[model samples]
Target: MKRILLFSLLLPLSVSSQSNDKMCETLSKINALVKENHFQPKPVDDSLSVFVFDKFIDGLDENRNIFTKSEYEKLSKHRLLIDNYIAKNDCSFMNDFVSIYKKALERKKSVLEKLETVSLDYNSQDSVKFSKDQFPFDLTENDFDRVWKKRLRFDILEDISKLSKNADSLQLHFTEIEKTIKQRVFDTNLCKVNSILNNKNGVKSILKNDFLNAFCYYFDPHSNYFSFDAKSSFLSGLSTSNLSLGIEVSMNERDEIVIEEIVPGGPAARNSKIEVGDVVTKVSNTKGEEYWVSCSSMETIGEMIFSDHNKQIELTLRKKNGTTIAVLLKKKVMKATANAVYSFIAEKDAKVGYIKIPNFYADFDERSPKGCADDVAKEIAKLKKDNISGLVIDLQNNGGGSMAEAIKLAGMFVNAGPISVLVDNNHNQNIINDFFRGEIYDGPIVILMNGYSASASEFFAAALQDYNRAVIVGSTSLGKASMQTIMPLEENNENDFVKLTIEKFYRISGESHQIKGIIPDVFAPVLFDSLIKRENSFKTALPYNAITTSTKYNPLPKNITSEIINLSKTRIDNDLRFKELKSINEEINFTYNKPRNPVRLTFTDVFKEVHDIDSLWEKVKNATEKENSLLIYNTSYDTKKLASDDFQREINTFKLKDIKSNPYLEEAINIINDYKKFKQ
Candidate 1:
């Protein structure tokens, strides 16, 4: 898997700033490298300059709260000059931009501090509608005052609604609780402003990175620039480490820190309350020091979790159901396999082996030569020995890694053919084939995917679909077929790095699933497709294209393919849970996509609104909980291994619990059975 740079918080904050000359030198190098090596690099002209300028400004003030309309107008003078600046290796425009942005930050800091000391009128009829697109920049100083108060009032009202929901359980005094919630809102906002102003290297360091990363990001969403310390911290996540809560997180488009995955065999896996896609709103330690994620940067949040000082902590996570839950957890020593692939058997009408690959993780460390493909091969062998009639490989939420491992894993199912095609920057194509000569366990196979199954995952799934090697299931895969690799800024110097999109992957049919992604043969009610960002969600994402290739291969018989699909569709259409899930998906779409109107700040009004949304999500939360769960169990070999360790067994039990109730997996089992029946 791609290494997460969790240790960035450990880097020293009190560091000397780079000179403008130094910054320009770095930018020049980056510009040259990207243009030369990027898969489809755009020219460094007016278009690129404008993109970088707008992106930099947006990154600095995403909420459009900091910069006034006039200030923004003043800054737009250098919009078209950025390309010229880069061509001349000049830092004058950036220097001017930073000087102006700093002033804006100082002004914003003052406004926040002033707002904190006073109690705002929560009873006001005025309301605030949050929309990234609809929200306008402050037109004047008076507008700033109005907007800030609305923002603060909205925050307080939200918390009040949350606290009052449990008033009966807590026997809360409304007036006192309101005061406490107001103080929290004030403290959180002020803290956010102060942290940025107090940055030791100044805002220049942060903005400089943003400015440079704009070019890299515009090339493709995956490309990035890393400073020396940043590079080290990012690469550090490749190794197995301890003192982890056993979860991985990502900042969503809304700037909410969302739990992306729960590491198996980790503390989080054991907790029934913790789950994927929960938004972490607040974090606190046993010492009663609490930090709100809304107010803190991701780096700050990382320090709070990974720091040696805080071992016991409580995370206040906001579930999609519009409810908040506090999960008390402690850091534990976890093993490398906490993130590894594991398998189980789902028994219904037939015995089907289910293998869950968290990601296409290759052993980056020399000491551990076992890659995901090798582990998968071993799992298949065990399942074959157990006499499984069919197999299900789960790639749900797998954000893919190691292209080499994906090729190897895909090879295990397909009998010798061109698995995929790779296209380089210069328009040269190379066919990536499964030359393994024979299949491992090719008895009817099903691959499960969701919106988060990206990169190498899409590659593997697309190949199987192309050759009719496996039946693809679930909603849709994350449409990202491009490959990226890191290169040093200076030759042989590992300190400064830039991850660039080097090539794109195509199916043996020559269709590139860039932003289009892979459409499953059978569509189930998509559980995780809500706010599940995909390639098309990214503005800079590459477009889908197809090429004419001469490679020939035969697919599974048309009659069999159509028969299996029809059988599965008939079963899904009649299932109550599946119908409920589909209804839930539609409601979720309406709730998120319909233009949000200004929500009245009154407790009664806000409470009703929150309740409606919460109820909808409650349905979503329990939609897949089958009254009659599938019979899921570990294989004999895994059961024997788990028998030796209680912790491993506990984790195994949790995995089975998920497998038992999963509607997607249940349907996959049904499909596999359908395939087996058709064959007979």
Candidate 2:
């Protein structure tokens, strides 16, 4: 039967009018392109079919809130048939899946509505597990009712915990507060359902896109299918500046859009009322079109804010103290440096220069090109002027950007040589060499990285590590080494695009750190290392492989490296704050990795759970921010450069304080100090 099904899958699909023609064509095109050009493409067989089927379902009902066990079982029959369906260019299966999911959403909505009138028992000893992984899906509609009611009660209890932290200040009775909280929860859930479905046409469109994305994921995590608009957005986000409010937002557990970070020197950073953790309640575009965030999809709100069509926007933010304020913001050209490199001189035993590259952004404006590589070079020049003995390049949390920029940055450290090797799908090798002849700053150097450092960051780090130039510190880096290029499906049109993985790169040492990331020379425990989902975590990630590659470059003497690493480790062990940080990381690892117990629904028990989690992180925050022995200062060159801009100056002020308090930076400084001593 399996052999017969495989033979049938190879046949040309019969076009069905019931299915979307564009979607069918897209899947077919993506299928052909991946098989032809992807770094490593898996055959469309039962294995691929099962992966896509499970992923699509998981994407829709991640928390197991929508689909019941019975519904899932009914859908599981199609698990092995996705390969056949895709091969035939048929999207009818998507329609069925969406229909079932739609019905499940409606059922959930009905339960939410029923929950509003029903009073929950606050003192009940019943326990509910918060994570979906900790429990199973409901067996029936009756089971859904019991599960959803518990979920509603849990949400209400959490809200009450937050609202009544200062019960005396609220001055509201418990009964009235409970009623208000219940109504709010019901309204939010209803809005989430309405926004997802939108109307008759929207449900199909949203699910169709989800299906397409899931189909693409089976090839590799880097390979993705993108609509014209999404493709444009993806390209623009790669080291490009956009006109915006300069604030980043993320959805919290309650589905509320909370401000995550305000970009330094951006419009939002200047607003005193707008703060991180402030909930965005509403947004209005330049056309005076208002969108209630609770009733709208985050994508819609994000488009309104980040889209070039809107030159101005007004955001209604709800503060922690329950006060609401609306701030009008005009679009400004936020430079790449707003989130790029910032240099400081750490004065401990010596003047150690510090430079952090959060991303390797490129100059999108060809006419006036000022890329991350150039920015780092400028900072290095300033640090050189400060007469620093050694330098620490912090690449922690850098998810990477332009490959060209990464190569250029690597050039600043080493002499002209073949820095990296890229192998295409056909096994054609291409050597990426740095053409620049001389080094900018060749002093004793330490590069700090964590699991979040990926792609171009890994490329740069790998080059330096292989050359034996920079001592790599911190945890293992994110192991992505593949390169992707965007291609339009149709000629002379910008309708559909696929960002396909074209090549996988290898370090100059001929080692390919694809799934397993770059292991640091000196082991330093990063506080959030375990929480990071590395490349190996992905089920379909490309396997690690190597090629015979040769590159000639002079390396720093390797004789004293072991001694330096040992000294740094001894310092970390002896330091009181460092010991505390290590202990906190262990506790964090346990808390995050351990099987969670069922949470008690009562306010007291819920509050305790909330407090314990918060306290665990609070300890980490305090340890990292503890006053260190290093005296950090901005360079004169940077001071003069920022003298003309008040916004940049203010940002620099905050960064200086942050750098002084960073334990990791302190440790990296110590390592560099050791390197300098060993070199002497």
Candidate 3:
């Protein structure tokens, strides 16, 4: 995962006051540390410099829409000089690049401002194509302006189509969308100017951070630099002192800052005024002085709202229904229970237990006393008391945390045995084993996983699968099996740290789940499989390797795996819900992967396209709901008493809905039931 940097509300104190001496001092320290402690250190040669140069440029202009070809050529002189510059602690190349970028931004801003005043015919047969790969930079000013105009037009057309269905209404919505586009562009430009280009200190810091990160990532994808603000946020997340309004925010494709999830018991959840998909337009202080926080990164928003605990902040949000509202929330210590282990009994032919492990969260600080391993153990004990014949541990979307917790958690299902092997760069192997003498439940266990299940989660699932203690089901897990250790540069300063990948993990079966994650024994239809993000997708990711281990574990009964797979295939073939899920997955894959031809600029064409897309998603939702109905399970919680607290009531309602609608959980329960029958 990318490290998020928290920003301060304070503007840059001095725009051109960065000292070369300070820059050199910081660079010297980083270079020395990288050489000494980096897992796979590389020599600071010309080849390394070229890699760093390209990475830095990509970080600056990711879309390749800024600096022209001529500008790039001008900076090519420093492509092979980065090593020398680093050795000498010089930043002359960075200064030159920043100067060129600022000028290009100014020119683009001027073009956007002028274009916003003119009206273009929406009936024309004009269209634009978008791609992730970098394109040739426009050589002439006219070419640059043309590229931006087409992009702006495409954005406006897309937004208008979403708002209006007919030609007449499209025109009205287009006008409104044009105004919004102009304002957003202007606001973004101003922010860049003030925070980056205009501020020498900010520019210097960014250049240093980017350059160091490029150097680190040249070794592998996981190792990178952490700025002061970023390090602070990372630490805070691991500790109980982390304070927030309790909302997960993400930037949508339309550049809108959307509320993705509301943390239970958080201020937003307590207020019940915000919903997922709400676009946050503005943020205000207690005095009602508002700032344009729309379309900003989550880190920037976190910095603005999380400055003080118990302080009130107001947000102006636009909902999916096109209604706008103001919500005031007091920032406080978010409840730890939000990430705690949660379980419920799924009653079918026989009672079965289901536990959802969000992550292997554990506080490294011994005094914290809160750990996921203990929580999961307790949940397992409770489920055993309920006399569940089978158990399903859902590890979906679990991007993993502590390795210690993973080993301990695996111990709950099996007696003492080797769980995994840790291989360091020196070719030394350390076997991580389970010391527990007794199993907690020892019943039929099914471990549910997805593409997002990574690191520690993979370790736990792989261990259980190795021991034949649990049947791994769902999509292949996220291929992230490397361990990272945070190494602080300055002994006295906690703000400067580098997360370096120090070791790789291999299962007791002698296979490393590095780039090739654990493959499920039974596969199900997963929507957005192509869109699922994973570490192996990166070109710079470390290659998968395996080391021989002497440890051995008990395997499943002969023919059991084949029997269960055959049974699952037969059941899924006749299952209407599974058929619908497959259909939904195919539609989604087709829609997203379809070719992008020239779209007629006419309102009718755009409206039809938008409507078709919306209809396809509606079918997917309906199919999902139908699948969820099969998993409906009864709960014993007293909702009437919980209804007194709005947040708790909402949480209970969500839990009930999830239990009813979870198709994956339902399948796991069915599989466990099959295993029970086989044992009989």
Candidate 4:
């Protein structure tokens, strides 16, 4: 019977509409492209079919909130037929899966609406496990009811906790919490329903992408399918003319839209009232039209924000200190600088220069004269003129950019050497060497990196580390050694693009930093290091493998690594701020790794959770204060006195504050100082 079903899958699929034909064509193209171009393409067999099926389902319902166990089983019947369908250009399975998912969403929405109408018993001793892993799929209505009830209770409890914290010991009754939960549920459901109903095209696009991406994942996690709209967005993001409010926003655990970053010189940065961590409660237009944006997804909020440009939008933000403020900001084209190199000098015992390369950004079109390599070279020249004793290159959180720029940047440090080895699909290796003669500043060097430093960033750091030219500091790097190239599938269709993993990068030492990232010689405490995601965390990520390289480089001084490690460890252990951060990280790890167990649904229990979180925040605040106190700005290069405009003043103040609060930078300075001492 299974063979018969597979045979039927090979038959020509019924031509329902133009959309179906287009989807089939796209899928066919993707299959051909992956097989031809992917670094590690899997055979389109039953095994791959199963993998694709599972990936597609998971992509649709990642939290396992919508689909029931029986529904999943129903869809599992076509698992072995996916490969045959793709080969025959049949999208019947894809259509069926999408239909099922849409129905499931509707059913789930109805269930939630019904739940809101019914009163939940808060005094009940029954408790629900909070972890999704505990019950990934529900078997029955009762199980879903239990899950939803528990989730609603938790949400209510969290809100009450926040309220209690603000009210200063004003205990909230169970009735009050229930009332808040009811209102929140209604609001959230309304938004969800409205979003679904209003954005049919968006929903269709997402489903199509999910279906295609599941097949793409058979190659690797990095290989992805970019739809027409997604391709446009991706390209626009890299373009210089991309317009926005200039604030990076994220949806916090509590569904609050929080400002994660205020882009320097952007409208949000210009508006002194707006700050990071500020919760956006409401957004309104100048015409008194208010948008209840709280609890909305980032996409929804973004659409509302980007609906009209050059318009004054009033934002109601709740500050971290629990104060509410409304700020009117006019949307304007952000005048962001293309320069990626930011430098400053440490005025301590010996003047040490610090250069932060956020990313190896470059204009591939060559429209601009300034690239990451050029900017870094300029900064190095400036630091050299200042007669700095040592230099610290900071790549902490640099996710990398242009490979060419990384090569050029690495060349600036080394006169001429092989930066990295690129391995193609056929296992052919190509040595990317820097032929440039003479180093920029061959002084004692230290490179700072964290979990977020990846790709080109890793290449630059690894090159320097391999040559023993720089002492690497901070947590492990992001371990993304694979190189991706975006291949346009259909020339006529702009949206048909495949970002295929075409090659893997290896260090000059013939070491691959694929899953195993570069380890810092002088390790510094990175808050939530374990929680940060890396290439190794992905199940489908490429394995760490190395290739033989014919590159020879100068090695660092013997015992330098051990000496720096010992000195840094001693300082880190003695530092109270570092101790607090370590303690906090330990607590967080414990919380994250702890097994999910049901606890009594009580106000005390909720309060305890809230209290614990609050205590953690308190520790973080104290640690930040201690670290900030130790920050010594380069008074010689103080831009505050030279600032003639509001933009410069705002940016300078932000930069100064950032520098003061940077513990990693301080450690880097110390590491460079240690290098100087050891050399002497």
Clashing pairs in 4: 228-495
Candidate RMSDs in Å, in order, are 6.4, 6.3, 6.6, 5.4
Candidate 2 colliding pairs: none
Please say which candidate is ahead in TM-score: 2 or 3.
Answer: 2
- Name model 2 segments beyond 4 Å from true: 1-18, 130-138, 164-172, 199-201, 228-245, 249-261, 265-295, 298-300, 303-339
The models' CA-based lDDT, in order, is 0.80, 0.79, 0.73, 0.74
State the lDDT of candidate 2 residue by residue for 277-382, as single tens digits: 7998888976869887888755577677777888889998876544457899988877655436778999888898999887898866676678899989888888
TM-score of candidate 3 versus the correct structure, residues matched by position = 0.85
Which lDDT tens digits does candidate 4 get at residues 375-460?
A: 88777777777788888888887888998888888888887878888888788889988888888888888888999899899988
RMSD of 4: 5.4
Superposed by TM-score, candidate 1 places the C-alpha of residue 484 at a distance from the truth, in angstroms, of: 0.3
Best by lDDT: 1
Give candidate 3 misplaced runs (Cα > 4 Å): 1-28, 42-47, 87-90, 113-126, 164-168, 172-181, 230-245, 249-260, 265-290, 294-300, 303-339, 556-558, 600-612, 627-650
Candidate 1 structure quality by residue, lDDT tens digits, 1-680? 22444345433321222367778888888888988999999888998888888888888888888888888888889889888988888776666677778787788778878887777776879876767483566567677677888888777767777753553443346577778888887787777777667766677777788888887887889999986652245235423345888888776756677888787778888788998889989988988788888766555566677776788879999876657789999888876554478888889988899999988988787577688998988888889888999999999878899999999988888888888889989989898877778888878888999998999899888878887878888887789999998899999877678999999888888888898889999888886486778889888888889988877777666678788888888888998888888888898888888876779877666766666676776686676665446788888898788888887876787777777777788888888888777778
Worst 10 residues of 4 by lDDT: 230-239
TM-scores for all predictions: 0.92, 0.86, 0.85, 0.87
The local lDDT score (0 to 100) that residue 500 gets in candidate 1 is: 93
Total colliding residue pairs, candidate 1: 0
